[model samples]
Target: MSRPNILIYMTDQEQAQVSFPEHPCLMPRTEQFAGEGVRFRNAYTVAAHCCPARASFMTGLYPSRHGVYNNVNTHTAIHRGLNDGVITFSELLSEAGYRMLFSGKWHISNHENPCDRGWEELIVSSPGDRQSGIPPTARWEEAAKVSNDTRGRGQILRPGWGHYLVYDTYPDQGPKGYENDRDYQFVTAAKEVLPDLTESDTPWCLYIGPNGPHDPFNIPERFADMYDPDQIALPPSYHDQMEDKPRIYQRQRSQYWDQLSEAEVRESIAHYWGYCTMMDEMFGEVLDALEASGAAENTLVLRMSDHGDYCGAHGLYCKGVPAFREAYHIPLMARWPKGIVQPGRDSDALISIMDIAPTLLDLADIGPIPEGVAGRSLTPFFNESSPTSWRDTLYTQFNGVELYYTQRMVQTQTHKYIYNGFDFDELYDLVQDPHELTNVSDRPEYQDIKQDLVRRMWRTALAEKDIISNPYATVAMAPWGPGIAFE
Candidate 1:
């Protein structure tokens, strides 16, 4: 039997709920796709931000070990390298003779392109709006100049478009067009590569990473006007002010939300949904091409997001600041016609994006790459009728000066415990308060509960080596409350 071809379609900053309960955008296609696969309901990113989370997915390591801690202060070379001891799943697959192709965002390393990282073919954009200095392709340069004229910002000087400048040039192509922006470039590259797939007998892996719904909220006019701003429903956390929260949360909210109005927020959400829909349409195109090329039945299709966005959730505009559910939770769907046991099933098991590599390795019948990879394969969850003793807790971390303090959280089915290695600690009874509006860390009645949670968290930290702590010692800390203050 031949190894299954792999197609990973990843989106940037898409929330898990965007396609839930059949959202207006992408819901139809998403539902059709989910029917052919396993939909992981509880999947989350190891890190809330882009670079760290993406690096973790690529290398199957945590942010601490990967060393791509944050977005602004970190460089890709600091963590990922061609000669670095770390080996990516793509490299492993390529070494095994799979033809690898990558299109769209390559935020992992500035030291080398995806081709250097083992991809046979590569079409990637810069990490972020930081100017690449490497002149873009003719189409990209033309788009940049047009974008500059549209925004009156002199030139499209950024590597990727920034959020603050939404009134910029519009992207005409949906997913498969000749437009030279990152999204269209990815689609065009995929279309160009499709014919070759039909002639090749070797297993292939094509990564399509789209930069939609990330920022600038500027899609083609047709997609942008798909939804009316007045009809869009705001998130439950949408508020004018996030009172009784940490100072950092409040400051972030003020910085972004204070400048926009209720209508504008709705408009942004609508535009985001439109972008999502456009991406979904693009997915359809890719799938169609795969089927036309006779690779559909043998291809393992995976759809996921790097992290999540905060579309007016908790009075926040973007992601990376607040560790709320909207920012970390992501959708994960995988379809393998031959390998998957149960199709159209939804598993609520706790999973992380980092698990993708291990899962792929297992499907390809490859040996474990190394011992340092923190993620485990989720194949068992897909095969078993009922998963027993599956991961009981999910962990996430945010480490950067921008976040003010390094924070790690351990969440179980019933409770969530957060430790901000600085001044505050948070405990939430997820069963009772699903919204996580109340912090019960300081309550005297939950002292025993807090202690037990701390013990469990310490054990997890020690086992995962995610945090350095002595399990023998007990944590002695006061509870954070409404009156408690932080800088």
Candidate 2:
């Protein structure tokens, strides 16, 4: 029998709920994919930013182990490169005689490129302003300096307004123009690659990662008109002031909130939804191509995102600080017609993006992941016999000096605990405080609850080796605090 093909479809910054039945975004194609597969309702990204989360997904290890802790950090080998001796899922599959191809964004390294890491073919975008038009050498040098800032390291700087030329093709500028155009090009690339299928004897692993619905909030004209700005509802946690919360959260709100008005926020969200819808359309084309190539039934399809976007939720504009569900929880759907025992079922069990590697290996009937890989295979879940051991809590961490400093969180089905090394601590019963507006950490009534959560937080850190000693332990909050206040 021929080996099964694998297609991992991913989006940059998408919230898990956007594809939910009630979300404002109409994703009929995605909904159809979910209906044909198993959807993981509580899936989360290990880290709430791009690079680290992507690294974890690729390596099946936590960020701390991989050493790509933030988006701006440039130590690519294990830091920039995949950690020394670490076996990437793609590398393993390639060694097993599979064709591995990577298309779209490759933010893993400043020095080493993704193609060197076992991807036989690569079509990618560099980090930073997508339209800067700077040469790779100059762009890397400039990016390195900017990332040296205490907080900016390891994060992709927001793009400025201009014509974005994707992979040196398709110049897109202005609202409702660039994002959709880029999606069109991505779809076109996938279509063009289909002819290669017949020439190869080995099965393939194709990763299509689109950078959309992430920022610049642009969409096609028709898609932008899908929803009225006035009809969009702001999240319940959208407070005018951060009040009694961590100082980092307040700082971030001040920086980005003013750039948008109430109407603009809604419009941005509507455009974001439009971008997601466009992504769905692009994915549908890919699915059709798979079927046309006679590769549909033999291929395992997995769709997910790097991380969730805030997109005006909790009075915040983007993802960085504030590790809320809107920023950490992401949509995950898997379909393997040859392996899945049940279709169209939903699993609420906790899972993370890192699990993708092991699951892929499992579907291939490969042996255990080399020792040291932290993620577990999800094969048993698809088989309808729940795994004997599964994680009950999910964790995320962020380290940004400008927006925040070293914040970590532990999320369970009923509650969430946020530990900020710099400022106030927070705990919330997600069931009672779904929006996470109320902080129950200091409340006397929840004292026992708080202690239990703290223990879990520490346990997770220790298990994942994510803990770091406070380097600035002596710095107290100055009366006025440090840095210029926007307000």
Candidate 3:
């Protein structure tokens, strides 16, 4: 069998439900792609932020091992980039004789050249003026030098309701021209480059990362007009009273979305939906290019987002420091027309972004997954047959890039436990409260469950080599617990 060419289509801050098969209104092309591929119902990002998530996506290692604790860009200088010692999937793919290409955001590290990590070709999307285009600092000390000061450039925060909004028409209006819009440029490059690469003898891998459906929710007027703000539906958890939720949740609401009236929240959600449709259109363009190139059959395609946005869920705007399902659970789909005999199935297996590297490497017939690679290969889940052995729980971690906070989470089929190192821990019974509106952690009845989850988190931390500093020497005891028996 001939080796397949790989195309990874990645978006920023996209929710799993936006492109879900049930809702084809927002991202029609993605829904169609899912119809021809397998959609992971419970896919998640190891970390909820940009740089850490992207680093895990590339290296197949958790943020703890990869060493990217936060977003790596102009603003975050303290933890700027991925460690140089880590090996990325691109590097291994390149070594395996595939032509590797990376376009769009490579926020992995402040490494001078991406070529060093294996992509021979790189086209960095300009982080437009609205995004501040704030250049990254040279070293860790520089972060303290300009604490919270975007180096004279302004922050991405807009004035109204703390939701970043630019109420303007599109096309050549901003510093980055509409024609030069990052997403447009990324698609244009892919359209122009894909045909030739498909025709080449060597199998090629192209990683396309587009910054979209994120915030600054400004989009072309056409898409912005798609949904009427009055008609937009609010998330069930939008008015989360913030009752049993942690202080961080309260602080985030006060800091960002507390002032937002119902109308403003609806309007923001409308803009977000519009932005999603616009991103879907861009994705359609690439699908058109692939079909035109006649390489659709031989190409293995992956579509996913780095993380999800709050989009008014829990009265929040962007991703919160806490482990909210809206922020961490994301869309993940894979399509290989020639290889996958039976597609259009949904797998409930718990998976993470870190799995992408190992899965892709496996699909490409690359040998022995690198030692210390922390993700499982998902190739087995492609077929129609169900695997007897699969993970019942999924774990994720979050640490602040701007604010130093530690949060680790372990989610089972029915429950979720979030340990906030600084404040209160959160335990949600998913079966009872799918929306995660209540926190049952402090309840005496659920102490056994919470204790078991805490032990799980500790074991996971040790397995992943995560550096979680816990003051309680109690956790140092048995793998299960003290006198408390694990149910």
Candidate 4:
């Protein structure tokens, strides 16, 4: 029997709050996949931003260890991609005689193309709004201009309050009409190549990356109108009383959320959901192609997102500043019928997206994961019995971007503490304030709890040799409370 093929479907900035058993309106194919597999309830991204999070997925190391601190494409200060010295899971898979195919957004490395990273057939999308010197709406127009298969009538650029620009396609033809969209193009490319993959003798790994539901809050008309904007409910933390929180919390709210009226916020969220539905349709197309090509039976399929969007949570729009569950927690699900005997169960495992690499290698039986890799193999969790040594806490770090901020978060099942190296820190009693509206870090009553978390964070950083140790170690390592200074 041949080795199991690996199929990874990744989305940019998709939050766990939307997929299956959460927001059930969209992503039917995704929901079906989850029904037949294992879903990780508490999977998180190492960093809240894009580039670093994607880098972490590629290499099993944190941002500081990987040496790509900020977003490479957007940040001028960071020119480095995944360090040449680090060995990626893909490199290991390639060496094991697996054929690799990559299509869609390749943001992991700036200088080296995906071809250099073990992919045999690479179809890279046009650079996004930030990279291209054009109106963000031009992305849609560029897609239409280049593809005869696209049914998008035209691109719509609607300017809102604070000069907020929305990019969407005027697709009168419904979901199938978005064939010209970037994600559709990417999935179509994958579908076209599936036949050859099934016929080939060697096992294959196909990585599908789509940039959607991330921003611009624009999608084809069919999807945008799928849910009534006025009927959409507000986020639980919509009215975040910013009292006692870090100064950046209020600043972020004022900068990003203060400009929108209630109606605009609703519409923006509605479009975001629509974009997710569009992505769902595209995902279905790829899944259909896989089944049609007879490769679905032997394929180990995984779907996950790099970080998440705020989606009006805490009165915020995009990711940045004061990391929280809305931005850091992501959705991770995997389905491999042959390897996983028991499916359709939710595992509340404290796992990081960085663990994906080693997990895939384990499934492929590729063994002896390279040295210096900081992630753990998730193969055991796929079994019926939970590992007694499973981790209880997860650590996430962010080193500033867009707004220039630094934050370290240590989270457990009940409580969470964030150490913002810039202005102030935040602590949340998840049981009391699940939405994380109130910051109890500076509160007198929670001082001891805060100190204990800080000590745990310091010890974890020391044991793990986290990169933030260089500057903040001396201060964080000192006698707990007095050293860090709560109030």
Candidate 5:
């Protein structure tokens, strides 16, 4: 019941379905530890993009509250930082006398690094990399040159724009070790820090973030070869064609992804799954380090991802304008050997990634996170008590990935509705068409359903004080306006 050491491992662009007990993605470490902790089957990110979702995780507030809805990287950003007066949970931990150590990606805000938020930065993909002072990795020179057959399977050549490659092998890698990879470097740093943590008197918190299995699923040949593309099958939704969905969804497909032949699509999935396997291996190494540190029995180990990847679902690669569940559903797992009553359990209770901040504070017996925060502590789910007051609806507040489009979503167990201010709206019967192959927003029978969802959307949007919750005559779009919430 005392303060426990916190060890967090957050991956990038990984979907929640992959961590299901029945999922096909091969993750040996996850499988081994499957019953050692709790697996949240309904976990989700508030936004699909990294910065907004990560900010939600760090602050327990949605993108609108945190004021970051797009990528916060230096080169290609519009709104490049979090809103003023934002307080990350790390700052609270630091005030409570915990040593916060971090390595790998921290895209929450480009204005300042994790150190500015209370963490001691460490490793190659250091949190400091988010700041403009750090040099970016050189890719322009390599992308401009005319390519031959030397291009890897993942490479998508662009004459002017930088070449897009999500999967590739390293020159230093054969089949055994991956010394040159960024993920390995980050994990190694976390591993090195674990030993020193055991000697310290302070209850510490260490965060390891790896930008992998994300895009350009770069890995060794050994990992990619693990899944034969021939045996892989396309997603059930791959043939949807998006004829019933929004036009922007169709445009995204036709412009970029639809070019891939069925063979290529299958190959892309194989590479993504293989990259997942590589991530699992890297995760195991950190767990091994924790075991060696002699704090394995008391440390609170967490495995989560910033958001989900399309990964060939609906003929898309990465997360973007789409409102598909493949892009929003995220993986979250937790293990606390000395604290949790039962190590092995899966909870179907609805939960958000933002809930992480307050959950940690609750577990540590620290003061609750700032009032008015969107996320409530998930302590009941962790304890397997399933609080009766838990929320049923999970909402998404998205602006855009890089482009600007105002969007909001509200989803229940059986139905989902997306309010897009840019174009049209969307509604889906999750029970009837689980793959989201059909859009029911335009159907006469579903009009009532749409209205019901719209009312809920407005209610939550108003409560959250979302930026898009405007009453302007032109932008106050949606078949049922904000006034419907009162009706």
Candidate 6:
């Protein structure tokens, strides 16, 4: 084992497409970063939301196993924290004599910060806002106070009240405010600590999480100018009405995003692309710092996101209740000069954020992770020699975001099946409908495919001890039973 120094730079709500060499979101530096390593073209999040996916990266366990089915923040949350004694990879690495430094957003829990998991926390975002992100009940008077023109340009109204500012510039910060942006601060923290870690003899781990390319896409005027709305084309699937899918999906679209005009959607996408480029530029700084310290050869740098955002695909802005591919698929790239075999290569192997913990342990020769962990080591793919026996089917669990919906997704190379506990199921043949324009769940011809996918779903749920299989009569609403795990 090379025992490389680990550096992780994570961005929030980044789309998987951004990692592609031909993506419209022009990120030369990020592209350079990807070229220096292996890009897992098929990387995905265990869950779509922030906390649950981040938790999976930390523990290498599914949300059901970690007891964080949804956001663990101060927003309409069912759980405010993780289950007791959840072992994070950082804890193991710290014990293995690694200096753990964390900067930027730590959305895993309100009850505890990264410090609790053996990290030396620094310059983090929303560290201890013990309140839920969404309140259980809204103030009627405040809702009534919203401006009469709720769905006007730039601002959009919710299903009824509450105006949401979609995209705009920082009013008070002017054009240069981006210089002091929180993302800049996160990078600054990383730069400040890199020197000390480089000089130290002990191996170290540094995590930089920048909050960007998330909701609203509010960015600096300079960055926004990089993209033109007129030139930006909405995703081909953006016109999907979602009529063939569940009513909840339609309701989510019609209620929130429908208010935005097509032009506005294009503008939002432009802003999102600009945001990605901004983060990419900041990331280049960290890369520069690493090279300056002369530890680039032995450092394992992981550039990825907690999850992805739908930057106007299916008329959705942020990731949530919708069981769409845009929400689950995330950009994942890894670079370790001494450890990685094929530099600047891409692997289509199905990878999960949860795979990070186990892969790091494996490369460090830290040996077996705790029992019941779900992720497999990505060392084979890193070596450019993926074993023939690798998994062909990938599964994702999404209990909810801020809003609750029991959605389980099982995707194979050719098809995708989504079991929406709240509504009817959805199935899409990726070969025919890569954009997911149609739902063939009810087609008789697709019944065989649906059945096979459902059986696979139960296989993962049963293996992970996922409690969603409660078949106590009234709640056992899945089209297939847990018995399918055996059948």
Report the number of the highest-TM-score candidate: 6
1-487: candidate 3 lDDT, tens digit per residue: 6878899889998988887756634778888888998889899998878878988999899887888887555442457666657888998889899999878876777644467678865576532222455222122122223333221111222211111232333654343234556688877887789878877789999878889987767777677677888887789998787879777577556543555677777777777888888788788888899899888998889999999988788877667476888889999988999887689888888888999999889988887888778798887877554677877877787766442445678899989998664455689999999999999987899978887887677556545545443211111112122112111
Tens-place lDDT per residue, model 6, 1-487, is 5588999999998998986888878888889988988888899999888888999999999988887777665334577777886789998999888899999888888878889888998877867554444421233224435554535666665321345667876642544446778888999989988888888788999999999877768888887888889998889889898888767666556646777888998888888888898899888999999999989999999999988887678877677567678888999898988888978888888888989999888877786688778998888877765666687888888875432357899999999999876566799999999999999988999989998998798778656655453321112345555555555
What's the TM-score of every candidate structure?
0.73, 0.72, 0.75, 0.75, 0.79, 0.80
TM-score of candidate 4 versus the correct structure, residues matched by position: 0.75
Ranking by TM-score: 6, 5, 4, 3, 1, 2
Quote the positional error of residue 296 for candidate 4 in Å.
1.1
Instruction: Rate residue 67 of model 1 by lDDT.
Output: 71
Question: In terms of lDDT, which candidate is stronger, 3 or 6?
Answer: 6
Segments of candidate 3 deviating more than 4 angstroms: 74-76, 126-180, 405-487
Better of 1 and 2 by lDDT: 1
Per-residue error at 135 for model 2, in Å? Answer: 10
Weakest ten-residue segment in model 4 by summed lDDT: 153-162
Alpha-carbon RMSD, candidate 3:
13.5
Candidate 6 lDDT: 0.79
Candidate 2 lDDT, 121-236, residue by residue in tens: 54676543233443323332232233212222112122111111110112334543444365556656766787686457678888888887676565567666667768888777
The residue pairs that clash in candidate 1, if any, are: 129-159
TM-score of 6: 0.80
Top model by lDDT, which number?
A: 6
2 against 3, candidate with superior TM-score: 3
Summed backbone clashes in each candidate are 1, 16, 1, 0, 2, 7
Report the C-alpha displacement of residue 276, candidate 6, in angstroms: 0.4
